[model samples]
Target: MLFEKPLTLEDIKKEPFIIEHIKWDAGPKELMEPSIVPSCDGFIKKEPLKGYIFYIDTMGDKPVLSLMRHTEAGFAETLAQLDDMPDELLKEAIDESKGKGCFGMYPINEKIKALLKKELGAG
Candidate 1:
């Protein structure tokens, strides 16, 4: 179920992690693991997702760095382009949510959203 007034990206940012629970989808939102796959094995800033494994890097500077599996940018490139998602998809979700008597549900990811705003290419 969704709230009458959806949570804004700012509000969602306060949380440790953001999730996008797609309704009626045949898959989970995203599966995370402690270790990144082969791509970022040496601790990289970014890496793309190939056939199966999308490596995440943690440089070990920040305390939470070691556990850093992936960044929002990498997440999108690997999975679906949340930032560049097509409008038709959004419309379809809205339709489905309404049918389920739900307003909508989604976790706000600032980094991805910011990238999306930039990708919009207007101001």
Candidate 2:
């Protein structure tokens, strides 16, 4: 379920399982790649941005599903939770995120989708 407050780095660090899942199972290899942007002269490679991460924030009274993206400074910014997103829009987000060469996008694979749904109580 969605939490009333956005997740913080401290909240994320408290959940080791979520971190390991993202590191070993859910996170795509492309997530580690730098983002490429078209520049005036050519293309510029920048630190990865806007790649989504799934985590369970246990800071509240109950476990809350959280979605976050990496910032330019390599910190995470919490976006929303499962209950906050409609199914159709979530599907579109996942579909559109694929095959984008990891450029300011998160590639949602089958494993990631399954985990997301399971954690969100949708699967």
Candidate 3:
């Protein structure tokens, strides 16, 4: 079932990814190479996956479904960093390319948006 829970900026500002597996106390992260990460150098509140959570092998024994959540600030940051372009420029591109199939941020942004939603929880 889909869940709609509001999150606070303060919470999200702390962690962008919400790894439900054993909470944060289970010592250092099992995955040496952290795949999912928090944005803004650690300033976001990730929420647990609401549906179809992916299984992480690194977290064993007490496996817990998890997801990451970030504030709109993070989204804007991602929008900038992902394309390596300024937000103003991107927005302009989006406006110019609108209605043209696969416009500016349609195809590519779709993927990034999916990833972001995935990181947060079920979309």
Candidate 4:
């Protein structure tokens, strides 16, 4: 019964964990709080979590699932800010962590991958 038909964003939203961890902000008020960030000054300059981000990628012959806690600023911008280094430096950093597991990216289980393929109409 895994993906009896092609899936869409709405279908992916059916996943339980995605709904729980991702917080959506309906307005500016949800973006900042004086209690958590004491220096909020009654307003936040940045956009807050707008929606859940569930993206899938094909790595080699397997499917990888990526769940990002998305904000109005978006995930790409955040990654770019964190990866402020030249290509050579990035390579060295990656090499140094060769055996360590990557954070936030995981290979989908075979059964789930099969189901997702069907849902994506790739099966």
lDDT of each: 0.28, 0.50, 0.29, 0.36
Q: Give me the runs in candidate 2 sitting further than 4 Å from their true place.
A: 1-50, 83-123
Local accuracy of candidate 3 as per-residue lDDT tens digits, 1-123: 112443332333344343232122221122222335679887455442221111111132321222222232322111111222234543443344345322112212343334444544523
| Better model by TM-score: candidate 3 vs candidate 4 | 4
Worst 10 residues of 2 by lDDT: 21-30
TM-scores vs. true structure, each candidate? 0.19, 0.32, 0.18, 0.23
Ranking by TM-score: 2, 4, 1, 3
**Between 1 and 2, whose lDDT is larger?**
2
By TM-score, the better pick of 1 and 2 is 2
lDDT of 2 by residue, 45-123 (tens): 8755444565443344443445666555666666554454344544554565555423233444455456554553442
Highest-lDDT candidate: 2
**Which of the predicted structures, 2 or 3, would earn the higher TM-score when compared with the native?**
2
Over 7-90, each residue of candidate 4 has an lDDT whose tens digit, in order, gives 344554466554554332121123332223434476444434655433323233333343334455643211111121233433
| Residue 88, candidate 3: C-alpha displacement in angstroms | 13
Inter-residue clash pairs, candidate 4:
none
In terms of lDDT, the poorest run of 10 residues in model 4 is 76-85
Candidate 4 regions exceeding 4 Å error are 1-18, 21-49, 76-123
**TM-score of candidate 4 versus the correct structure, residues matched by position:** 0.23
Candidate number with the higher lDDT (1 or 4): 4
Per-residue error (Å), model 2, residue 22 = 9.8
**Per-residue lDDT tens digits of candidate 1, residues 8-107?**
4343334333333221121112333223544545753333321211111212221110011234344422222122244444444334334232112222
Each prediction's total of clashing residue pairs, residues at least 3 apart in sequence or on different chains, is: 0, 0, 9, 0
